[model samples]
Target: MDRYCRRAGALALAVTAATATGALAQDYVIGVAVANSGGLAPFSQPAYDGFKFCVDEMNASGGIAGKHPIRLEVRDTRSEISEAVKFAQEFVDIGVNFIVAPPDGDPTMAMGQITSPAQIPTMTFAGTAPILTSVGEYVFGSYPADNQQAAVLGAYAAELGYKTAFLLKSPDAAYTQFGPAYFGTVFEANGGQVVGEASFTMNQPDFSAIVTTIQALNPPPDVIMTSAWEPDFPAFIKALRGAGVTIPVMGADVLDTPTVRGLGEVVEGVVHTSGGYPDPGSAHAEFNARFEAATGKVADTNYVVNGCDILGMIDAAVQAAGTTDAAAVGQALAALPETEGIMSSYTFAGTDRMPMRSVVLARIEGGEKVIIRREMADPATMPAP
Candidate 1:
């Protein structure tokens, strides 16, 4: 045969082999790498549980087109970038069709580096950075990037007449770093002044020094804006209140974490920005009820909602593509229009691969998280990366 004819025949043979392999599979395995242990574990756990709940529900509803059972193979990334990268390699080696990675920007970026080039479709938990999608066409995130969420918060602060803010930044992670920067820019643009800015790594147990820095200001800030999570989040709040800093506290999406909600009354009156809410609409409310009934637990965090929605989206894309091929699934997801889920409507937004779903603003009031407002995130306001 001539060279062109040989090449075409080879390509056809490869496609036939791939199709047969996918069709013959008794189970389609989805690989999950989450921060099951580490600083991010508390938040990641709920996301993983929510993903599990979605997959289980789909299974109960007759198992993915009534034939091929979808199963998840989970691995704990321990909230470490190295672990996430390492496990991404393993997922590729094991030939899983899709990978669900931790949402935190750093780990998600690392997973994208590994999975994207390997032609694996991936979705992340945190969706903290817009650059996550820049990794490749296969990487997807449901949450608006940090800048979009921050823009909403900045506008809200302006609305609330916040004149000055003390900024507390988690300097080590992308989630914390980029969020506060966009927030600062938008806040300042809105005629609010950032009185002072302090930075800390998440692992630092003590917030006394940072508290002192904020308190040193002559008049002090009228509001404090921060992007901190877990142990750091509560500690920062405790220290600020302890130092007699009574200014209203405002924070980014990190505050929506389950651990932060557990702070209860102490975090009362604290304003937080979030990518999704527990019950954003009727569908989300139904999801929360079904999740509770299935697991015997309350859906306390937004991650739970996002997790279910992401998995559901993947299921939809797979059905549309008619095969577990990674490239086909990615294309289907990108082309899918404003599909509604428990969290919010998601559209892959062409090659951008970023969703412009709604953002939730909530405050801790009377020892419970009360939804203050919900607005569709405008990506146009986001700063260039």
Candidate 2:
């Protein structure tokens, strides 16, 4: 009996040692839940590519603190809010400390409910300020807010002498509604008049009625400002051109896409604003190069840079926290003062999980987009516009 007991103890000790070795050999798994297979895939794919590139580069450099190689466990949310929430929970269940989500306001907003309760840190490529304001902790956004873009575009329109401007937007989408609301407020405050305003539904195949309504206003507005996603802008532009409404068209960040450019001459001379320019020299040149080389296409102005920044930010926080624990990473992310990234220099401020300042404006000219200006001052510091 004594000999048998000694042999059993030895076997148990060897098993325990093997288990410890296996645990030590395991790599840290990071979750990436994105809308990479839906309507937003065009935007999310580049973001995924960017995150993969950043992670690959980091792993090549011996990974975070040289302790473990980080592995990204990607899940497609299909642009659905429920799917996003489920993926967040799934990631948590799988013991992933970090997550990066897509560019939709609703899905990202839904992630807040999941990650906050579970105490998992989530960074969204979407820039819906209200999401951060409503959720408070457990969520950080890397993109500039739509309201900020609206304010800047409004101020620019005011400067450009577009006193009587027409506002067109999609009433159904929160992102679409918020932009024009903020733009109208700033435009009116800056001595510009929103002479006409109209709202349409998302995925609507035609905007001819909206265009006709705007044109029939007593005195036509000087500039037409668009704040819709999906079929609205393309339809509106095509309808407006068909109706011979040639006034300059302006819009928010949604206009800074290849889709707009693909409209060819219909969208020519349209002005838009973006958080970061898509040029090679803009902060993340290497990222852009790698993205183009890998995807066989130039990067567009979605959240790809923001996604890269999200990964880089996580890496930075991991470096700062010195651990892969979710709580430690959350603290590090919330406490991050500033970090230079591909999108923009991010700094947390005003209880929001993103930088309060740091935005840029871009315009499409000669069938190509160009950065009109960068590093625009925060709204609080700027002259009352």
What shift in Å separates residue 337 of candidate 2 from its native position after superposition?
Answer: 1.6
Q: Rate the local accuracy (lDDT) of all candidates.
A: 0.80, 0.74
* Worst lDDT 10-window in candidate 2: 376-385
What TM-score does candidate 1 reach?
Answer: 0.88
For residues 42-76, what per-residue lDDT tens digits would candidate 2 score against the true structure? 66776776777677877877666555688888888
Candidate 2 wrongly placed segments (more than 4 Å): 1-26, 278-282, 381-385
Tens digit of lDDT per residue, candidate 1, span 321-380? 887787788778877778777778877745377777788899987666788989975666
Model 2: colliding residue pairs: none
